[model samples]
Structure formats: C-alpha cells, structure tokens
Target chain A: MPAIVTTGITKSFGAGETRTSVLRGVDFEAEAGEMTFLVGPSGCGKTTFISILSALLSADGGALSVFGTEPNRLKSGDLVRFRRDMVGFVFQQFNLLPALDAAENVAVPLIIQGVSPRKARQRACAWLELLGLGAHLGKLPSELSGGQQQRVAIARALIHEPRLLVCDEPTASLDAETGRQVIELLREVSLNPERAAIIVTHDDRIYPYADRIAFMADGRLTHVERPDPARIPARPIRGETQP
Target chain B: MLGIALKMLFGDIVKMLGLVMGIAFSTLLMAQQGGFFIGLISRAANTVTEAQGVAIWVMDPKTETAEGPTAMRDVELYRVRGVEGVRQASPLVQATTTLRTPQGRSSAAAFLGVDDASLLGINPRFVVGSPEDLRRPDAIALDQLGFSRLWPGEPLATGKEIEVNDRRATVVAITEALPGFTAPVIVYTRLSQALSYVPGGRNRLSFILVEAEPGRDPRAIAQAISAQTGLLALTTPEFQRRTIDYVLNNTGIAPSFGVVIALGAVVGILVTGLTFTLFVNDNLKQFAVLKAMGLSNWRLLGMVLAQALVVAFIGYAIGLWIASGFFDAVNQPFSDLKGFWLPWQIAVMVAGATAVIVSLASLIAIRRVLRLDPATVFRG
Candidate 1:
C-alpha cells in the first residue's frame, strides 16, 4: 500500500480577483519503502503539494490519505496528532531553532508527544551519534556548518520514528559534496518497508537517489519517471555514509 | 516546549533585559510613589498616632483634623473627665508657632502643650536628655528635626536656648518625633508654658485626650463623651482615619500620586508590550517552525504567556528590591522621610498591577503568534 495517496487535490491563495490558484487538481502517490522526489520550478506548487501531503496545510478540495487514514477528514486536534505521530519534515533552510543545541532541536517532536526531556534527549543523542554528529550535540545551530545543520535537521525529522518523512530542498543550502552525503544518509537511515520519504527539490544532483520522481508544473502533476538503473550510483554516495 | 520557549526568550539577552527593565521601571514608580503618598498623608494623622496610650480625643464639634483644632473651653476638659468610662481626661494643645534660633533665623514649628502633670499627648522617643527633664524651669523638648532647624550642623544636646514667640524657651531635651504635615519641627512644653507662647482667648484648651477605663470599649466611650459634652469625640484609630481622610479629600496629594501611579502602569504596558512584540517578531520563523512540527495554537499561546510571566517575575522582583531599599535607607531617626514605608499591601497591589501590565503586553505578541501560519517555515 502507498504511504500517501491524493486524488484531485486543489488549493489557492487570496480571494476574488486577487486570488491565485497554486494547486489545480493534482493527483499523486508515494508508496512505502521508497524515496519519492517532487521536482519542479519555483511557483509550480511543489512546496504547496508537499505542505498538504504532510498535513502542515489543508487542500481546499481533495481526497487524501496517508497510511490508509484520510488526513482531510481528521478533526483539528486529530490532525495535529496525526502530524505529530506520523509525519517528519526537513526544510531547505534547515529550520533548527537557533537557541537550541543539536540534541534539543532533535528532541522536539518526542517532547511534543509528551516524552520526558531527559529520555527524549537520550534518544536524540543516539540519533545524532548515528549521523556522525555525536561530538556536536551541544553545539547550537549557529555554530554548525551547512552539512552539520542539515544532518541535525534529519535527525530531528526521524527522531519520533514517523511513518512519513518530508523534505523540502533539504540539501539546497549545502555544497555538492555535502549534499550527496546528506542524501546518502537519508537513503540509508530513513527508508524502509514501513516508512517513506518525499523530497521536494530543485537540485538535480541528488536526483538519482530517489526511487520515483514526480514532476509538477503550472499547479499540476505533469509526469512521473524512474531513474535509469545505470545512472543510479551502485557504490556508497560518500565515504562517511551512515549505516 | 516550555523550556524551549524560555530558552528562546532568554536567548537574546538584550531584549530580555529590556523587557525586565520595562517591568522594573513601572513597578518602582508605582510602589515608590504609593509609599510616598501614604507617608505624606499619614503625616496628617501623626499627632493622633503619637498620642501613645490616649484611647479617645474630645474636641470642638467643628474640629476636623489633628493639624487644625478649634479650641474648646477649659471647662470642656473637666466635662470630658466627668463622662462615663473616662479614666482620665488631660488637656492637650495643638498649635503652630514661629521659632527663632540664636542665629536670628526662624522656621514655623508645630507646638504641643501637654498636661502639666501627666504629659499625656507628647510621647517622645528621646534622642538626647530624658522626658523627666521637661519639668525644669522654662524647659521644652525640641524634636530632632526642630533642633536641626534651630541649630544647623550642630550635634544634638540639651540646654539649647530657642525663642518661641519671643519667649525664652530652653530646649532641655531632644526628642524623636514624626514630621507633621503643616511643619517639620515639633516643640513640646507644659500647657502653662504653651499658653504663654500662643496668643489666644482664655479658652485655651485645644483637645482633651481621654483614656477609657479598663475593659471599656474606646469607641463606645468616645460616643458617650460626645453625647455628654456635645463635642466630636473619636477613638484613636477613628481620629487617625478622620485626619487622613481630611487630607486626602482636601488636598491634591492623592490625585498627584494617582497620576504617577497610573503613568507607571501605562509605561509598563507600553514598554513591556512593545518589546515583547518586537521580540516575537524577530523570532517569527522559529515559532512558525514549531507550529509546523505539530504544536497546537493553544500550546503556542502558553509558550508566549510563560515567557511573559518570567519577565514579569524578574522585573517585579528587581523593582521591589529597589523600592524597599529606598524605604529602608531613608526611614531613619532624623530623616524627613522617616514616616514613609512600602506597605506590604501596596507591594502586593503593585504586584497585581505588574501582572496586569504583563498580560496586556503579552496580548500583542500572542496575537502575532496565533495569527502566524506554519507554512511560512516552508516558504524559506
């Protein structure tokens, strides 16, 4: 079964003459156990589509389900819980709180779910260690480099073991080498038969890591493609890739 | 979440201090102004409070305050002594006179003439000499403030000669007395000596200090005294309230202090509210990120409120400490500010006002956070 499936989802902004429709009846699907990339130009509704898919936003009209549960039908409170327990997000800018050290930033989702801070931080420490950030757990986001910050964002996203992980230009801020390492880490640590990731990206360098890629344009899903097997890297994408 | 909220608030040390200072400034203004006002008005009743063991006062029916009493006939003192429950009724005089130093300078002084035998009204906390020394020939006790006025820069001593209305009066003792509303200096002398200093008719009695018989209610005794003598008689606390009420109702002191207190609250709200809003505006992206992470609007609101309360607590504590220190530093034996105090009641009331200021200030920041959309995090 697919982790998320949407049919004829639509969304818009403003009202009357000023209103601009951002999503025009889009249909899409992301199956479990694989990475799906939503790629398009700016203003093409890629971020808006992922926003709705992760329950950060609601579609004006849609039939939407993640892991067999319809998100569009959930009440306000239930939708919050649905997002808290099932979805993880990594932003292009690596939206880690400036005041929080790495471990505290990574512990946020579990803390949101009423986990004691000490235990949440313990789990966060383990995750950061797994991502080669064990020594940097006490460092604030400002003290981190781009690659280090992105890894912290990934650890934060995966800390609660959510069923769906969403990334919006996660490596857009990193250099080519760091971007490849971050994508390899995501592939190794986040993808499994019970969970999936959907990345919205403008960077094509990390394109081969996705199992399926959906292209969006003018608020519509224009096409879907699977990367050629020979083009996909057979070896580890970087030397320091985590297990 | 709460920890995150506090960490976020304290992350910017400058803004947090600005917030704390806003609250502290207002708290200090309200509390300090309130204490001074209370101290100023209470001076009007200082005479009533200082009459130590006197339980009731019997005066002319028109006498409205301790500072200005309409003289009653000396017979009225005897009449009050005859009332039921009257243990003893002593003649007490209240009047203001000019005192001249040997240096030929002068300041207006509040003059009290106590009973020749009992010295009922002028209960002095002596700084030098003894109360018994008042019985010496041509002797008078000068208050510490009055002595400073007459003999500037001189150490307190007995036997300082001062002139009261051209009468040679020797200050045989220096006494500690609360500064009064009409004058800073106080002179205590025998009734006969006081009568010699002030020019008035044969009816020289100002007020009759009454001590109720043991186990008798002073309020009821006061009522009996008023009924028997057709004078206004009041228990000590009742008379103190009457005197303070007269000042509060008749003078602009209350409203002047009131304006300052109100301005304190307004300034607190403006400073705290504007700073908190700016702080929240600066951290808008962070709040949006939290919102996107599945935190509810209610939780976000709580975080803002918690941040506000922390600022309020620290600011109020700092303000209270400074205000209390002001009261402590000046309320000394000879300081003109001796009678002023920060009442715990005023402290508590200011705290309540601080809470109100913080809540009003937090509203702006809270509104911004609540109206924020989580998708803004995705935008960047």
Candidate 2:
C-alpha cells in the first residue's frame, strides 16, 4: 500500500453564502520509498494539499489516509500522536523556533513524542551529522546561514524517522545550489524502504531528485512524469534504501 | 512545559516587574491597613482583655465603659458574693482626676480606689509599686508613664508628694507603664479616700469586680449579679463588645479605615487589571506561537495564570516585608500601640485578588491566542 493516499479530497474556507473553494476533488498518492515532487505556481493549492495530506487540515469532502489510517477518524490526542510519530514537515521559510538552538529545533518532533531531552538531542545530533550539520547544532536559527538553517530544517524533518515526510516549497527560499543540496538530502532520507516523501515546490532545480514528478495548475494535477534514468545515473544506495 | 512557562514568563521581565510593583504596593497597603484596623479593634478591647481574670464587672445599667461614669451600690459586693460560683467581689471607685506635675498639671487621670485584695485585676506590669502600696491611707500608686508625665526628669521616689483633684496625696509607690484610655491611673485607697478627693453621691461605687470559681462561666455570674443587684453586670467578652460598639459608634476610625480599605481594593483591581492587560497585549504573538506549537487551550491559560501567580507572590512578599518594618519602627517607642499582623488568611486574600485581576486582564489575549492559525507560522 502507498504511504499516503487522498481520493477526491476537497476543501473550502468560510461558511454559508460566502465560501471559496481552495482544493477541488484532488486525488494523489505517495508510494513507499519514492521521492515525489509537486510543482505548481502560487495559489495552485499545492501547500493546501500537503496540509491535508499531513492531517493539519481536515478535508471538506472525500477521504485522506496516511499509512492506511484515516486521518480524520483519529481523536484529537491520537491525531496529535499520529502527527508526532508518523509525519515530519519541512516548510519553505525554515520555521525554526527562535528560542531554541539548531539541535533543539531538530529534536522538536521527538520532544513532541515525549522523548527525554537528552535522547532527543542525541537523535537530533545524529541526523544533523547525516545532513553535514554536526558543527552547527549549537547555533541558534538566527546565528546560522540561510543554507545552514535550511539544512537544519531538513535534519529536523528526518530526525524522527517519520513514515512520511512532507515539504511545502522547502527549497523555494534557498539559492539553486543550496536547493539542490536540500533535494539530495530529502531524496536520501526518503530512499529507505519504510519511508516516503512528497515535496511541493515552484523551483525546477530539484526535479532531478524525484523518482516521480507531478505537476499541478489551478488546483488540479495536470501530469505525472517519471525520472529519465537514461539522463542521470543512480548512485549506490546506503542506509535503509528500498530494493 | 514548566520550563517553557518559566522562560516565557521571564522573557518580558520589565512588564512583569511593573505588574509585580503594582500588585506589591496594593497588597502591602491591604495587609498593613487590615492589620492596623484589627490591631485597633483589639486595642479597644484590650482594657477588658488584659484583665480577663476578672469574671464580672457591675456598672450603672445606663451605658458601657469609657462612656460616662456607671455608679453602682458600694454594698453590692456583698450581694455578688452570695451568688453561686462567686469566689469574691470587690468594690472599687474609679474616677478621673487631675495630676499636678512640674511640666504642668495633666487632666483625665484614672484614679482607682481599691483595697489590697482587689488588686487581682491590675496587670502586674505596673512596675513602680506593688498592689500593697494602696493599703496606706494616704498612699497612691502612679503609673511610671504617668510619673514621667508628672515629674519629668525628677526621680519617682517613694513618698513623693502629688496632688489629685486638688487633694494632696503622696506617691507611696510609683507604678510603671499603665496608661488607660480615659486617664493615667493612680491606684489609691478604698471608696472613702477616693470620694474624699473627688466626692460624688453617697453609697455609690464606680463598679464592682467579681471573681468566679475555676471553669465557671462569667456569663452566668454576670446574669446572677444583674438579677440580684439590679445593676448591669458584664462578662469580659460582653464588655469588650460594648467597648467596640462605643468605638464604632463614637469614633471616626471605622469610617476612615473603611474608606481606606475600599480604596485599596479598588486601586488594586484597576491597577493590576490595566497593567496585566498591557503585558498580555505585548506578548500576544508569543502566546500565538505557543498555541501553534501544540499547547492545549487550558495549558496556555495555565501559562498566563502562572505568570500572574508569580507576580502576586513576589509582590506580596516585598510589600508585607516593608509594611512590617514600617509598623515596627513607627509603633516601637509607643509600646502600648500594637503592630500589624499579616496572617495567612489576609495573605491568601491579597494573592487571590491579584490572581483574579490578572486573569480577567488576560481574557482578551487568551481569545486571540486560541484563534491563531498554525498555518500562519508557515506563511512567514
């Protein structure tokens, strides 16, 4: 089964006689171990789609299931636990808590899951090292470079080993080279047999990292494109890569 | 979570300091005023309380003590002794007399004509002479405070001569520090001597002092004395209530303190409420961030309340400390004046008021926080 599936999902803001639809019968899926890319112009409902898929927004109609569990059926506390335990989100602006250092930001998911600070920090440090950010763990978000902060955001998203990783324009704020590096990290983290990732971005530079690319326009998926294996060679997989 | 709450609380230290100061000033005022008011009430009753060993006092049925004189039959002591639980009854003539002093003659002195046996009601703190000094026909015992007022720098020696109501009397023994509200008391001989100096009607004594058997109710003795003697007999508590009623009805203290207490409470509510409202407004964004970070609505409320509690506690501590020092320093030389007492109940009241004011102030900010969109955190 796919890691995430949304069938004919729709969302609207406001009520009775004053409503505007943001998403219209959107159907999408992210298979395990695949890096899926969602590319669309602004206001195309890409971000809203990711929000729904991550259970942050309730669908106005139809259904959304993450890892076979219907997101809306979970109780509030169970929903929080589900989000904390099974999903990791990376935002475009690198939304790190200003009061916390880089390692603390990365450990947020584990902390939300009630892990001890020491163990959370240990896990955060390991992920930071994996993302080539070991030396930047102690620096606050304000003290880090834009690229370094984005790498911290990436590390945070992957630190808890969430079953599905969701990114909303994660590289839209970074330079081309930095954006490529982030895309590489997302691809590597999602390559594990038990995990999947869906990244929504306007930037085209990260397209090469996706196993399958879906294009969205005016709140609808227009096309799906698989990577051209002939144009780029795949590297020897490490960690828990899928077969 | 507690750490998060503490860090958030301390993040706006300046605003919190303002809140603390406001609460502290109000709490201190409340504690001090309440303590003083209670102390004043106790003082009004101190005349009876300090002489709690005396079971009953027989007075003219017209009014309470400290009013005008209450003349009762001088022979009523015999009738009082006949009652059950009656141990002894002593007749004393209490009158206000003038004392001639070097500085000038002072008026409104409380002169008591007591036999040696009736000295049981006098507080032993009266230092200059023992109760036996009243045994001499011409002897008088002047309180040490009264002695200071009378003689000034001169030594209060035994056999020193002083005038009472223009009648010559010798200070056979000088008692120490016993100043009553009506006058500075000078204990002299029995009803005859007191009448000779300040003569009133015949066969009348100012009041009768009654003692009862151990564990006997003073109330029962007082009732019996009134039934038999046809005079107003009062237990210590009854007399104290009468004294309080006199003070409340006659003195300006109750209204004055009432106004002050009311103003303190109003100022506390307004100042604390306004200051806390401003503080919450200043930190609304931080509250939004916390809410977005998955803190429940109740948890967010707890955080604001925690801040309020910390402010109230710290302010109360500082205010009470200062009030205690001020009360002690001011009432020190005048030891007769009782100092303020900040009991736990008053502390709780002050703290609780502060918390309520702060919580009311935070309602607007809490509403704003609960409505925040976590999606906004992604926007910027």
Clashes of 1: 0
lDDT of 2 at B307: 74
What is the TM-score (0 to 1) of chain A in model 1? 0.95
Q: Please provide TM-scores, in order, for all candidate models, with all chains considered together.
A: 0.97, 0.77
Quick one: best TM-score, which candidate? Answer: 1
* Fnat: each model in turn: 0.70, 0.07
Tens-digit lDDT track of model 1 for B221-276: 99988888799999999999999999999999999999999999999999999999
Top candidate (DockQ): 1
Off by over 4 Å in 2: A34-47, A91-108, A121-158, A168-191, A198-243, B64-82, B91-117, B126-207, B245-308, B335-337, B351-373
Q: Which stretches of candidate 1 lie over 4 Å from their true place?
A: A235-243
Give per-residue lDDT, candidate 1, residue B294.
89
- Candidate 2, residues A1-243: lDDT per residue as tens digits? 778788888888888888878888888888887889998888888888877777667788888888888977878666656666777778777777665778887776676556788898998888888778888888888899888998888787777778878888888888888877777767765567677888887777667777788888877777889978664436447455321
User: Clashing residue pairs, candidate 1?
Assistant: none
